[model samples]
Target: MASSSDPKLPPLMKAQFLEAFNKPYVLRSVPLPTVTDPHDMLIKVDAASYCHTDAVLAAGQMRPNPPSFPHIGCHEFAGTVVALPEISTSPFQVGDRVGVPGRAFHPCGTCFECASSPTAEDADADPPGYSVYCPRSQNNGIDAPGGFREYAAVDSRQVAPIPENLSAVDTAVLMCAGVTVYAALKRCRLKPGQRVGIMGCGGGLGHLGLQFAVQMGLEVWGVDNADAPLRLAGEVASGARVIDARNVDATEVVARLGREDGKQDRGDMGLDAVIILPESQDAFDYGVSLLRNHGKCIVVSFPERGFHVSARDVVFRDISIIGSLVGSNKLLRETLQFAAQNNVRAVIRTFPLSRLNDLVAEYHKGRGGKLVIDMALSDGS
Candidate 1:
């Protein structure tokens, strides 16, 4: 472990800040955040990944109340610990490579939601108390400053140690996209040989979900409009089925593969679960139709517009619609460990911090895989 005195800490640093909603982020110098809380650790950010949530927040889509102006926006990132609070009891040490997840708020340990087991089967029995997904909690990159800056003062609970083999870029993706899908799968509780379909398998989160399902021994099926991502999925995940959502109906394709009809001669039965990674209402509606009795449809995407589902279909078909947030701290650690052990990697495109505006433009136009900001290389603007 390296001492805090070993690294020279700077008083000022460059960051991308949102001065107002629907406005371009201004890259400027700002005072570095200090560790005020006992559990706070100051991190020197190396890489940060862009998420759809960041784009949504930038567009001023947050309803009722929005995060105050001049907010830094990026929740998924990895860095080296530069300093720790004097009273800190966190396992992390200075100079330790760590990945920071979006959940920056500390759980109110007294609530039932915090005390109960996260893996419990009964959803209603133990609701989330002060977890990051809780309505009252302050969210990183939304309600609070985030990793878009050169340095961040993060809660120790939200930080996970990065494995030796994984690079900062890889750890950044795993912080958000990786753990999200991992927790969603855990919620599905699908057994081995059970069929699972990824609605947007070619997407950043979808591709990772496909890989996880395959690793868990579930018969995986990927639905996407593009050929490139599907081909990549085929190459990486063996015995995975890919369907083109552009021509053929996604629901129909899944049904045909799963043999949803009472025809024993065709193939397997209906899918046990379908993880919806796209924010499209069509995808959500179609995903429900592809499920077997008591099957689940895990929704992981955030569509700006509201989604509609048939209440009659849900009740009659005995289908469950589960909404998954980012993930818990325990799940985040497990996700990193799983990726390290299985050699699962996120496909990423790196951009210098100077090109952040251009990167945001490209994100609006739609891009495959995750887009990362490398803080090391700057244009010296």
Candidate 2:
């Protein structure tokens, strides 16, 4: 029974707990988590960040719900390996920087979803790269305890080693926010020089999506409800065309985007694709409306109710509304690497773990970039 009993590690650690719905998280001292599986490695969390889904989870509204109450608050976490389990043959060792992206934790590689080859030329494949859809899988932060705690027991197979160039905090935000939108944008399948509109293009996911779209060689027009997000998007991707919906009407925006040739005549020549990233159903309808024939409407967030997309428009216009979850393990690695090489980084405002509630309150009100709890810093800077 000689597991990772590092004397340097404390038996108990401080963790965030959402004791009840619609209440602030309470910090409690709990016993350190232990490695259960052979491949599970104990990690000392260096940083973690909250997303829009954290609020929904705290409200007790998210479906298929978290495993239990007093749930840990963040899926986006990055840290250094502190201890390795016995019998683990994985190359990972203590002191290695790594991140667990919280989706597809225990992917049964034998299942139909996981077994299906992405390189296979079978067009009838049952949806390739849906890594989170494995029937026997459980997510790190959502369906189980997340990384708000000081330490976590993670599967080595599921964790991605941090690139030498990326810090733990930047890698943390990229885990959830970056991967979600990266997956959604890829769903569009638009070739280079093609047009794609990203709804909610200024928020955390939107900003990353705009930059990724630019890197992918697509002509991206990003639309936000206000000017602040547009500013953020502009700062991230110089190639992106940032649009403020408040300043310009949606119809006019759609018309302007359609007229890529600058002719200004309103017609059916709309965007080639629209990647919807906002957590509003109205965005779904609006995204569908902005698409041309056979254009894709990639849905990313979960609104309160279902989308009110027009059936007639979907049928006649051949609008394909695709629902995307987080990206596959391979895609997540690619995003982290692409971000490192391309200088694509999240605009983060850091605070210590003590100020998580403060950030959450401000985040609920909405903001640009990602909010992070820097465990390495004592003050809530």
Against the true structure, what is each candidate's TM-score?
0.90, 0.92
The list of candidate 2 runs beyond 4 A from truth reads 119-130, 257-259, 262-268
Instruction: Give the clashing pairs for model 2.
Output: none
RMSD of 1: 3.4
Alpha-carbon error at 120 in model 2, in Å? 4.2
Per-residue C-alpha lDDT of model 2 across residues 297-352, encoded as one tens digit per residue: 88887787767788877787777888888877777788898889888888898877
Clashes of each: 0, 0
lDDT of 1 by residue, 7-66 (tens): 477668899988987888899997778775777788899999998888788888876547
